[model samples]
Target: MSEVVLITGGSSGIGKSIGELLTTKGFKVYGTSRNPEKYKDSLFPILALDVRDLNTIQQTVKTIIEKENRLDVLINNAGAGITGPIEEIPEAEIKANFETNFFGPINVIKSVLPQMRKQRSGLIINITSIAGYMGLPYRGIYSASKGALELITEAFRMELKDFNIKMTNVAPGDFATNIAAGRYHAPILNDSPYQKPYGNTLKLMDAHVDKGSPPNLMAEAIFNIINSKNPKIHYKVGNFMQRFSIVLKRILPDKLYEKLLINHYKL
Candidate 1:
């Protein structure tokens, strides 16, 4: 039987691309959306799911298992973005981002584990961000939330080893997606101390996303991972510079790397 796959936040963007490609490859794909009705024309079924809502997460998983009898792969691609100066960002927004980007995926994983363990086989691929590897000036909150997910996946992988289940994190660099449209942006207050710098960073961030690589690259990478016998703990999909930045952080001194980012962002 073909692998049964579930991709959260799959109504559009990277998740949509992954789901579409996998479906064409003969994998049974179900994508999730908060408003499933809006995506009636989606190539794959769009199950109603809200990552921040435990009840919705549980029901969605149950629905899939009831129909498919098994869920062979889970792509935890549901997440939100927030961009603002750390101090200026409201506490509520920060927590909200964590709810969607961090705790949300954890709950979804928990909901699916029982069935996965019963089958003694499964693969969970978390869609994290390249920014998760390090703090970015204006997108600090997004970085922290995704970074937390990355670390937790490392621990989760070890915990799932005994159950014959595999867990991995796939961090993508800027992709041409609608994430920017949905991201929360703190107002660029004319009198606020960070007004000029924050505004400039925001513009640069948008430009990067506009010029980002195709989302299908991520789909191809995930497809390969699903077919592999031993998938790595972490996989990164992006342009050379974006992937190299992670390596540079490892080899460069803290301050030197900070300087490079500062210059890159023109902070």
Candidate 2:
């Protein structure tokens, strides 16, 4: 039987690109998006799913298990983003981001682990971001959600070691994904008196996302990770600018790093 993989959020952007790549590479790809019908014409199987909905995740896994007999890789790639300063953001909006970005992936991982454990060999890749490691000025809530995911992934790596179930956290920076296309609209923070001057931040952030790297590059990176006989615990990929920033964040003093980001981006 051919190797099989299940990817969440496979309808568009990085997830969609990964699905297509894995299928072309001879892996049987089963993907789930909330609106599967929109991707009806794709060659691989696409199912409707809401990752936060345990029932949806359970049924999706059950159906795949029946068809594939053994699942080889599970990619928890479903995520959304929001941007706003922490104090100015509402509690509900914070929870909303966590629901989609944190809880959603957790639900999928919970559903897949049983099958993965039974097999004693499986790869789980969480599509985290560079934001997970370092928070940015405007995207506090989104960064928090990914930060939560990073913690969970690290814990899983150790806990699942006995079962030989591999878990990897991928942190990519500035990919030209439709991510900004989703916007995630962080509630009405502009209405806050404290956040009034930052009304233009959204436009600035969107401009950066629009001009970032292509989704195919991220997909290819993920493709390589999934195919490796021995998977890694974490991987990072992005454009040269992001790479430099990651390095600078380490070598530069705290005040110097802050000054560089403020002066360079004109924030």
Candidate 3:
């Protein structure tokens, strides 16, 4: 029997690409979206899901198991981006961003753990961002949310080791996706100190994403990770500069790293 794979935020972007590729490779893929009807013509099955809603997550996973008998992999790709000066961002907006980017995935993970434990084998992949490793000027909230998920994935790896369940955090630098269009922009005051810098930096960030590597690169990385006997705890996917920047942040001095980021974003 083919392995069953579940992917969230699969209506479009990287999630959709991964779903299509996996389906072609013979995996029984089920992709989730807030409104699956919109993707009625998707190559694989698309289920209605809202990661923020625990009831919906539970029901969807239960439906998958009832039909497939097993879920070999769970890909947490559903997330939202919030961009603005950290100090200016509203508390409500920050909470909502975490709701989708961090807690949503956690809810799904918790719901699937029981079945994964019973199977004694499973793979969980969380799609994070390069910003999670290093804070970006205007995208602090987004960085924090994804950073939280990355840390949680690490803890989960250790806790699930005994159950033979594997987890990985895949951080993609940037990809041409609708993420920018859907990103939440925090309200900026005309007199705020960061108004100009925030606007300029945000533009640069969007431009970089416009030129980012295609989603297929990410799909390829995920495909390899799925087939590996033992995948690494973390995988960074993107162009050389983007992936190398992570290493630079690790080896470079704190002040130097800050300077590099400032210059890159023109902040």
Best candidate according to lDDT: 1
Poorest 10 consecutive residues of model 2 by lDDT? 188-197
Residue by residue across 1-267, what tens digits does model 2's lDDT show? 788899999988888889999898999999888888888898798997898788999999999999888888988888888876677667887887898889989888888888889999899999988877666777878878888898999898999999989999888887778888675664545467535435567777778788888888988998899778887777888877777787888898999988986675467
Q: How many backbone clashes does candidate 2 have?
A: 1
lDDT for each candidate structure: 0.96, 0.83, 0.93
lDDT for each residue of candidate 3 in 36-102, tens digit (9 for 90 to 100): 8888899999998999899999999999999988999999999999998888888999999999999
What does candidate 2 score in Cα RMSD to the true structure?
A: 1.9
TM-score of each: 0.99, 0.93, 0.98
Q: Which candidate would rank higher by lDDT, 2 or 3?
A: 3
Candidate 1's residue-wise lDDT over 119-138, tens digit each?
99999999999999999999
Please state the error at residue 8 of candidate 1 in Å: 0.2
Clash-forming residue pairs, model 1:
none
After superposition of all CA atoms, the RMSD between model 1 and the true structure is 0.5
Ranking by lDDT: 1, 3, 2
- Say which candidate scores most in TM-score: 1
